[model samples]
Target chain A: MRPFSFTKIDNAANALAAKKEKSQFIAGGTNLVDLMKKNIAQPEQVLDVTTALSSEIEDFTKGIRIGAMARNSALTTNAIVLEKYPLVSKAVLAGASPQIRNMASTAGNLLQRTRCPYFYDVTTACNKRKPNSGCSALEGENRMSAVIGYSEQCVAVHPSDLCVALAALDAKVNIENSKNKKSVISFGDFHRLPGNEPNRDNNLPENALITSVEIPSNGFQKHSAYLKIRDRDSYAFALVSVAAALELQGTRIVAARLASGGVAHKPWRWYDAEAFLKGKEATAANFSEAANIAVQDLKPLAHNGFKKEMLQGAIATALQQCLTV
Target chain B: MSKESTYSRRAFLKASGAFVMLASIPYSLKAMYVDVDKLTVVPKQALSITVSINKKSYSVPADTRTTLLDLLREELHLTGAKKGCDHGQCGACTVHVDGERVLSCLTLSAMIQGKEVTTIEGLADGEKLHPMQQAFIECDGFQCGYCTPGQIMSAVACVKEGHTGSVAEIKEFMSGNLCRCGAYNGIVQSIQKVANA
Candidate 1:
C-alpha cells in the first residue's frame, strides 16, 4: 500500500473539515484496510472518524435509532434488536464472522464495496475501480454478479446482508451534510444501480456522513426471517438471500415486505410480489406464487443463470419461515 | 498592488504555468522534460503511536499503513498471534481490544492508540494457562496448531458472550476461525467443556 497520512477527527465539524479529494473516512477499517493492502484503494489521507461518530443505540416511541459507529456484533446481540427487530439481528449475524462482526460498524457495513473477484484483482480491467476501463466480469467468471439492474459497464452486486434487511424493514439513513444540516435517506434510495457510472455505489453526497439507521416499529416483528444461501453454512457471501417480513392478521397476510440480495446492484425489493402476497392466505402455494413473480423479471448472466432458480427457492423458503414463525 | 509584489506574482504565475504544462504531459513523455533527480524525490512520513498490548504500554513509530497484526508481530515481537491470510479471511490474528474480540489483521495500528489489546500471549497467568487454553488441550482442538491461538481467543469470547448453547451455535459463532485440518469437532468440544464448567 502507498504511504498515507492519518488524521484523527474529534467531531463532525472537524471530520468535515478534514475531508479532501483523495481522503477517505476510516470506520472499523475492516474493508478499507484490506482494499488499501491490495492497492485497490490508495487514499492520500485517512480520516479516523470512528471515535467522532456516535455509537449509541437509542429507542423512541415508534422506532429505534442505531448509531453509525455501532458494531455489527452489538447490533446482533442487542436485546431490543433481538427481541423487536429479529430480522435485523439475523441479517447482521448472517454476514462475515464473529470477529469481523465485532469490528465492523453499522455505517461501514452499508458502505462496503462489492466482493466481485475481478474488482479486487488490480491487473484485471474493472469499471468500478477505474472508470471506463471496462468490466472483465461482464465476460469472465460472473457467477456472483448481479442478475438485475446491471449495466454493461459493471455487474457487481452489493454484498451487505444488513442492507437487505434494512430495505425490507423500510429503514431510514440519517446523514449529516458538510453544512452540518441533517437529512434522512430512505433505504430504497440509498444504494444506486450500476448504470453508466459503476464507480459510484451509493447516493451519499460529497462530505455527507451517515449518522444512524432508523428502523420504524412494525407489526411484522413477530413474523420475519432472513434466509441467506451461500457456498457454505457460514462465513461466506450470499449467493441468493431473501429477507421476508409479513404482517399477518390471523391466517391472512395483511402486509408484506420482501427484498433480495446477491441479485442486483442494490437490495432488490419485490414490491409487486409483496403486493401480491398482501391480503392472501399465508400458505405454501401463495409463497410459491410470490416467489415466482419475484424471479420473473430477473435478467441473469451466462454463469449466474442458476441464481434465478436459487432466488425463487430462497424466496419461497424465507416466506415459509416467516409464516411458520 | 505594489511594484515588487506584482513582479513576484508574475514570476510565480510563470513558474506555476510551466509546472502545470509539464504535469499535463503523459508520464512516458514527461520524463524527457523533467529532471530525474527532482522527479524521484518524495516525502515518506511515519506517525508516532502509543498502544497498550497485553497490559504493557509501548510507544513506537509506525507507518499509517501498518496494521495491528504487523505492529504486534514485526515491531513488538509478539508472534503468538499468527498472520494467516492477513486479510481478515482467516481468524489467525484474533485478539481482544477493550475486552471484545476483533481481527488484528484488519485493524490499523494507529487506530488503537489508547485502547487495550489482549493477544494470545496474554491469555495465561504466567505458567498457568487460561481455562479455555486448558480445555483446548484436554479436547485436542488442534492438529498443526497454526489456527489454535485464534480459535482459543474466539472460543473464550464465544463462551463469555453466551454463544455456546449447542454444537451448531458453537460452529456458527466460530466460523470466522478456519481450521485447515478440520479440527472443528475438537474445537467445539473445547468450547463446550469451558461453557459447561
Candidate 2:
C-alpha cells in the first residue's frame, strides 16, 4: 500500500478542514485499506476520525438515533435496537464478523464498495472504477452480479445488508460539509443506479462526511427482519437476501415495504410489490404474486439463471416470516 | 499486644488473601476493567508518556506512525499480537485498550497514551491459566494459533458484552474473530464454557 500521512482530528470542523485539502476520511478503514493496497484508492493524506467522533446512542420517545460513528457491533447489540428494530440488528449481525464490525461504522457500512470481481481486480475494465472504460463483468464471471437495475454498462450488486434494511425502513443520512453545513437525504436516494455514470454511487460531494443515520418510528416494523442466504453460515457475503416489513389487518395487508440485495446496483426496493400487496389479502398466494412483481423485470446473466428464482424465494420467505409473526 | 490489635491484623490479612483470590478467579468470570480517558501513546514531539502493561511501566519514545501492536511487538519485544491482514480484516492483533476490545493493528499507538493496554500475555496469573485460555487448550479452540491471541481477546469481550446467551448469538458475535482452521465448533464451545462458568 502507498504510504500516506495520518492526521487525527478532534472534531468535525477539523475533519472538514482536512477534507478541503482533498484528504480521505478514514472511518472503519476496513474497505479503505484494502482498496489502497490494490492501488484503486491512493490518498495523499488519511484523516483518522475514529476518536474524534463520539459513539453515542440516544433514545427518543418514538425512535432511536444512532451516531454515524457508532460501531456496527454496538448498534446491533444495543438493547433498544435489538428489541424494537430486530431487522436492523439482524442486518448488522449478518454482516462481516465481530472484529470488522467493531471497527466498521453504521454510516461506513452503506458506503462500502460493491463486491463485483471486476471492480476489485484492477486488470479488468470496471466502469464503476474508471468511467466508460467498459465493464468486464458484463461478459465475464458474474455469478454474483446483479439481475435487477443493471444496465449494459455495469452488473455489480451493492454488497451491503444494512443498506437493504435501511431502504425498507426509509432511513435518512445526515451529512456535514467543511463549512459545518448539514443536509439530510432519505436512504433510498443516498445510493444511485449506474445509469450513464456508474462511477458515482452516492449523492454526497467529495468533501461531505456522513454524520448519522436517522430511522423514524414506523408502526409496521414489529414483524420485520433481514434474512440472507449465503454459501456458508458464517463470514460470507449473501447469495440473496431480503428485508421485509409488513402490516396486516387480519387477512388483508394494510401496508408493506420490501427491498432486496445481491441482485441490484442499489438496494433494490420493490415498489411494485409494495403496491401489489397493499389492500390485498395477505396469504401465501398473495405473497407469490408480490414476489413475482418484485422480480418480473430482472435480466439475468448466463451463469446466474437461478438468481431470478432465488430472489423470488427470498421475497416469499421474508414475507412469510413477517406475516407469521 | 492488645486483643483488639491482634484481631484487626488477622482481619486485614484475611481481607488481603481474599483480594488475591478474587483477582485469581477463573479468567472467564474475571472482570477485565480498563480506563479509556487516561490512555495515551508515547510521543514523537518530545512529549513523553509512560504506559503500564501487565504490571510493568514502560517509558518509551515513539513516532506517530507507530501502532500499539507495533510498539509491543517491535519495540518492547512483546510479539504475541501477530499482524495478520493488517487492514483489520483479521483479528490476529486484537487487544484490550481501556477494557474495550480493539484491533491493535488498526489502532495507532499514539492514540493510547497513558491508557492500560492488555494483550494475551496479561490474561493470566503466574502459573494458573485464565479459564478462557484453559478452555481453548482443553477444547482445542485453535490450530497453529496464529489468531489465538486475538480470538482470546475477543472472547473476553464477548463474555463481558453479554453475547453468550445462545450458540447462534455466540457464533454471530464471535464471527469477527476468524479462525482460518475452521475450528469454530471448538472455539464456540470454549467460549460457552467460560460464559457458562
Candidate 3:
C-alpha cells in the first residue's frame, strides 16, 4: 500500500475539508482498504470519518434515516428497517460476510468499487481504473459483467445489494456539500450509468460527504422480497439479484417497485416493468411478463449472456416471494 | 563436479547474493518501500497513536497505511490473529473491537485510536480457555488450525449476537471464516455446543 497521511476527523465539516486531489474518506475501510492493498487506489491522504459520522438508523414519521456510517450489520437488524423496510434489511443481510457487515458502513457500501476482476488488477486495462485504458472485461472472462447500462468503455456493474433495495424503495442520499450546505439526491440520480465516466461511481458532488440514506414510507414494505442468485449461499457477489415489492388490490396490482443487481452499472430500476405491473394481476404469468419487459432492452456480453435469462427468473422469483412475505 | 559439491556451491552463492541484497536494502529499498520511511518503519513523529489491545494499552508508532492485522501480527507480535487472506476474502484476521467481531485485515490501525481491541490472545481469562475455544477443542473443530482464531472469534460473537438459534443460522453467521480443510461440520458442532451451554 502507498504511504499516506491519515486524519481522524470529528464532523462532516472536517471530513469535507480533509478531501484533497488524491485523498479518500474512510469509514469502515472494508472496500477502500482492499483497493489500497492492491494499489488500485493510491491516496495521499485518508480521512477517517468513522467517528465523525453517526451510525444510528434513526426512525422518522415518514420513514427511517440510515446514518452514512451505519454498519451493515446494524443496518440489517434495525427494528424500523425490519418492521417497515424488510426488503432493505434482507438485502443488507444477504451481502458480504458477518465480519464485513459488522465493519462496512452504509455510505461506504453505496460507494464501493466494482468487484470486476480486471478493475482490481492494476496491470490490466480497465476503464474504471484508468479511463481511456480500454475495458478488459468486455472481452475477458466477463460472466459477472454488466448486461445493461453498459458502454464501450466499461461493462462492470455496481456491486451493492443494499443499493438495489434502496433503488427499489426510492431511498434518497443526504449529502453535505463542500460549502457545508446539506442536500438530498434521489436514489435514481445518485448512481450514474457507466456511459463515458466509469471512473466516477456516483453523482456525489465533489468534496461532499454522504451523511445518510433516507428511506421514505412506502407500501411495498409489507409485500417485499429480495432474492440473490450466486455461486454460493454466502460470501459471493450475486450473479443476478432482484428486489421487488407489490401492492395488490384484491388480485390486481395497485403499485409495483422493482430493481435488479448484477445486471447493470447502477441498480437497474425496472421502471418499465413496474409500469406494466401497475394494473396487472398478481400472477406468475404477469410477473414473468413484467420481467420480460424489464430485460427486453438488455445488451448482454458474450459470457454474461446467461445473466439476461437469469435476471428474468430472479425477478419472477423475487416477485413471487413478496406474496409469501 | 559432484552433485553434492555443485549443490553446496550454488547454495553458498545464493546465500551470499541474498546477504548482499539485504545489506544494500536499507538505502535502496527506502526509495521504493511505498513510503518515506526505510521499508515498514513508519516515522513515530508523523503517525504516533495510542490504542488498547487485549486489555493492554499500547502507544505504538504505526504507519497510516498499516492495517490492524499488520499492527497486531507485525507490530505488537500478536500472532493469535492470523493473516490468512490480507484482502479479507477470508476471516483469519477477525478480532473484537469495542466488543463486536470485525475483520482486522480491512481495519486501518491508525483509525482505531481510543478504541478497545480484543484478539484471541485476550479471549482466554489468563489460563482458562474461552467457552468457544474449549468447545472447538472438544469437537475437534480444526484440521490445519490456521482459521481457528478467526472462527472462534466469529463463533463467540455469533452466540452473543443470538444467531445460534439453529444449525442453519449458526452456519450462515459463521460463513465468513473459511477453513481450507473443510472443517465446517466440526466448527458448526463446536458453535452449537457453546451456544447450548
TM-score of each: 0.94, 0.84, 0.91
lDDT of 3 by residue, B29-138 (tens): 76666665434532332477699998899998877777899899998899999989899889999999999999999998887889999999999998999999999999
Docking quality band of candidate 3, CAPRI definitions: acceptable
Worst 10 residues of 3 chain B by lDDT: B37-46
Tens digits of lDDT, candidate 1, A1-325: 8778899898877898789888899999989999999988888889999988998988899899999999998898788898889999989989999899989999999999999999999999999998999999999999999999999999999999999999999999999988899999999999999899999999999989999999999988899999999999999999989999999999999999999889999998999999999899999999999999999999999899999999999999999999666
- Model 3 regions more than 4 Å off: B1-45
Maximum-lDDT candidate: 1
* iRMS (Å) per candidate: 1.8, 6.1, 3.1
DockQ-best of 1 and 2 = 1
Which residue runs does candidate 1 get wrong by more than 4 Å?
B1-42
- Tens digit of lDDT per residue, candidate 1, span B34-134? 76653442255698889899999999998888899999999999999999999999999999999889999999999999999999999999999999999
lDDT (tens digit, per residue) of candidate 2 on B148-167: 99999999999998999999
TM-score of chain B of 1: 0.81
Q: Residue A64 deviation, candidate 2, in Å?
A: 3.6
CA error at residue A205 for candidate 3, angstroms: 1.4
Runs off by more than 4 Å, candidate 2: A61-63, B1-71, B87-90, B108-116
lDDT for B53 (candidate 2): 72
Deviation in angstroms for A268 in model 3? Answer: 0.7
Q: What is the TM-score of chain A in candidate 2?
A: 0.96
Backbone clashes in model 1, listed as residue pairs:
none
TM-score of chain A of each: 0.99, 0.96, 0.98
